[model samples]
Target: MSSKSTQTQFDKNMEFGNDTTELIRYITKGDGAGLAYQWLSTLVDGFGHRMVGSDSLEEAIDFLVKSLEEDDFDDVHTEEVPNLPNWVREDDNVEIIEPRHQRLNVLALGGCEPANITGEVVVIRDLDNSKFVNVSGKIVVTAQQFKGYPQTVKYRQSVKLFESLGAIGVLIKSVTSFSINSPHTGSGAEGARIPAASLTVEQADMIDRMFQNGEKIVIRMNMKSHSENHTTTSRNLIFQITGAFRPVNWLSHLSFSGDQQHVNLFKMKRLDEIVHLLNRNGILLGLVNNPSQGDVRFWAKDGIPSVNYIPDKAIDYYFYFHHTGGDYITIFKDGDLEYTASIFAVLGHIIANMDNWGPA
Candidate 1:
């Protein structure tokens, strides 16, 4: 609205005021309801766990580029980000050799060194104190402990603690309390020389019980991982609707910009995880445990008001699908995708029309 352009040119494509309301209403009704959901579903189903440096992820990015271009955005492109940690999971096997022959469900943590070791597991139920038992030449096992992700993740990040004690490997209990034999994968073991992986909560609990009963819990872990620490290249997709011309105040969100000032919260996919992790350790960096862990902390650090754009409607208790094998499109309810799309589209429209956001 600020720019004076010829009416016949008619190419600004900016809308404001009641036009925003009408556009939002348009996405909710009839065919528009399912647009976002459809695109998301197609991506997930076609790509199937698109990890960095993988061919599937690259192909998926290409797919997104085409989709956004078809939608006629002002500009749609991917900025190549080099030197991303690309630790490929070659093959892993965790079997209880001493007690029985049960292969536990496991996922290798990113940046874990390639290793194949069969050692007794030293179960540490409470990681707060562990001076009693000698973990030298053994594997360390920790649990989620119902303390939410903030507290639970410390066990995963404590690879050096166990390694200093001569522990050869580490196995952390997944972030979710509820488990149906799903191993959650994450990246906290970067630059670690020893191997690390996540085991299901059920199996971790069983290990705890055995340790309590004075049983020699011996497990063999054979994991193979290839690290491409600074060699691999991936992309950050950038697309936006052109806003009305009133100085264009933009809302903040953490990105893969690698700006040390801002934490990266871009990889997190669940609103449930974000909500549950908030307000745990009092009031530090939005109160979500550590600044290195949560992505939303940097915005808070800069005094820029920000919100997690993810939805909170009918959130799952376990977030079982997130970063797990069950993350495919089969779990979504009828019109779930469409409804979420509508909400996002509406929000985008509002932002495009806004004069400015945050501080003056």
Candidate 2:
């Protein structure tokens, strides 16, 4: 068959005939490809970091709602969710006053109370019970190895434990395995109020070495971090696409009669088909095998099976850029957003047209 005839036959097989062909071609080849990138740019560049309770976050939510409305999506709205305490770091300084006078680069951990202290630095190589003593009224320094974030986060979030022991302040080495003098910052102790900061691995190692050599290591830390306890309203943006077929009460009754395992298997099959369709359309390259957690867990608890897809290359850069000052629009490559948006559009179209998508 001629190329034109082959193309014509392929178009006829599409479920929506010319409409499907036009939509797919427009998404893959037209300006629809850049939609994701454009939206991301507006969110990151225009509104800045969307930290909870921050003005930027509220603005971002508004932007998403408006964007969805402009796209003519049905039922575009925001749902209020619990807010986190607003924490901001104003200024911080760390200096080694003993053994040798030198300054160190640091970033105050989020939600850490502000404090200024000059005390003898004690290095704890591990979180063993034996290391808990003699930490009173002294600066506690702990080394962090490159365990996954979930596994190693306890070291940073232990401010309450350290505070109860009368420790004046806490300094944790960056948890990341790779860094160029970057000090990562994350949530501080949940309930305890104490000053906490992260130091570059090199700085932490030097301090540890000095302490191990029996050198009198005194350090002065000045941090101006602050947190507001008041709760603020936040929102989750949701956009829905109405399916073509109407739901029937009998279908839900029949669905519950099947073996539970079979129901799960069918859901997995549908998910696999969706993934395959995106892959065949050249939207997805490969799967990311890393175990990372995100908002998908919340959706799962609500009985919704959601997939979190990050670009293949994004998995490598996630630690370095995510939740850091390095998270900016510049990190995204050209066509990255466009491709992602196209994939989502195609998936939404397929699901919306399904003959039987059980239960509301």
Candidate 3:
């Protein structure tokens, strides 16, 4: 992948005229690198975890709207959206009490019901019904290796399967491929809400080993997590850079900064063009065939062609810090943010300036 070769290919296949070229050049050379980092710093520093329905989320939305307005962006506004059930974990503790007392690291899953239980730990190696020994009145510990998030997360996210078998509580191994003694938190599916939490891969493995060694493991769990039934309003901040030309309403390209998985190649030709453009500018980016399941899914469902781009090397950043107490501005490097901002700005400017930039 020589830069000269990429540039030659990009020039030969160019469809948009001089305006698009000029816009892309200006964006790539300009000092818009600070924009993304500034926004990220403000969000993480000013408002701590912006969970849905939390005051932090509202404050973050207000901050975004104000920042966009200050930058003189066109159509900067907020739209009210129905909020999901807000779950708050005030206090939670899980400890091994019987087989040599040791406190374990745990994070209560969102939407999990609160409970206090003391029971022998039962390890479920597989989901096979035939191998099921009666796990009645026990704390079930299960670990599933990461195949993919959607495929493997079901064992942990759905509590009904464990509850129906008379499990008092549940402890699932974190979904991440690696862990630094950190537990990840995510929402559970709509089902029998049970006292459920996530344990680091190491911790879960240790528990499983103890169960296998004919050691009786007695664990005590105290979870104060709860949720409000009443719905509240949340805001989605929108900032539009109105195009100079008449915008095409039929197609759209979306780049999400939320999740690490890339998805949905609605317009493959346009994607190829963008990839070439980025590569020509010496910005190495790749597209993967994975379901993003990010916010872009909603746009795609509404009959618009959309695509999502997650930054390279974002997987470690997301798993280690995102949605956890460690998600602070300090976790990000200045150079990385600058590169991300420049690439996004270039892509956005080119798309905004292209004539008849819509679905064929």
Query: For this target, which candidate reaches the highest TM-score against the unseen true structure?
Result: 3
lDDT ranking, high to low: 3, 2, 1
- Candidate 2 displacement at residue 101 in angstroms: 3.5
TM-score of each: 0.77, 0.79, 0.83
Off by over 4 Å in 1: 1-21, 244-293, 296-305, 309-318, 358-360
The alpha-carbon lDDT assigned to residue 315 of candidate 3 equals 56
For model 3, residues 20-101, the per-residue Cα lDDT tens digits are: 4454455445555366677777777778777787898888888878887898987787888885676666779999998799
Candidate 2: global Cα-lDDT?
Answer: 0.67
Model 2, range 63-169, lDDT digits (tens) per residue?
88888789887778788887657676677998998777898888888777777889998887776662556898898998756676667667877777788888888
- Note the Cα lDDT for every prediction shown: 0.66, 0.67, 0.69
Q: Pairing residues by index, what is the TM-score of model 3?
A: 0.83
Q: For residues 279-342, could you state the per-residue lDDT of candidate 1 as single tens digits?
A: 1211112212233424566665664443443334322443566567666777777755554454
Candidate 2 residues lying further than 4 Å off, grouped into runs, are 1-28, 82-84, 128-133, 244-262, 285-293, 355-360
Off by over 4 Å in 3: 1-30, 128-131, 247-252, 255-266, 288-295, 314-317, 357-360
TM-score attained by model 2: 0.79
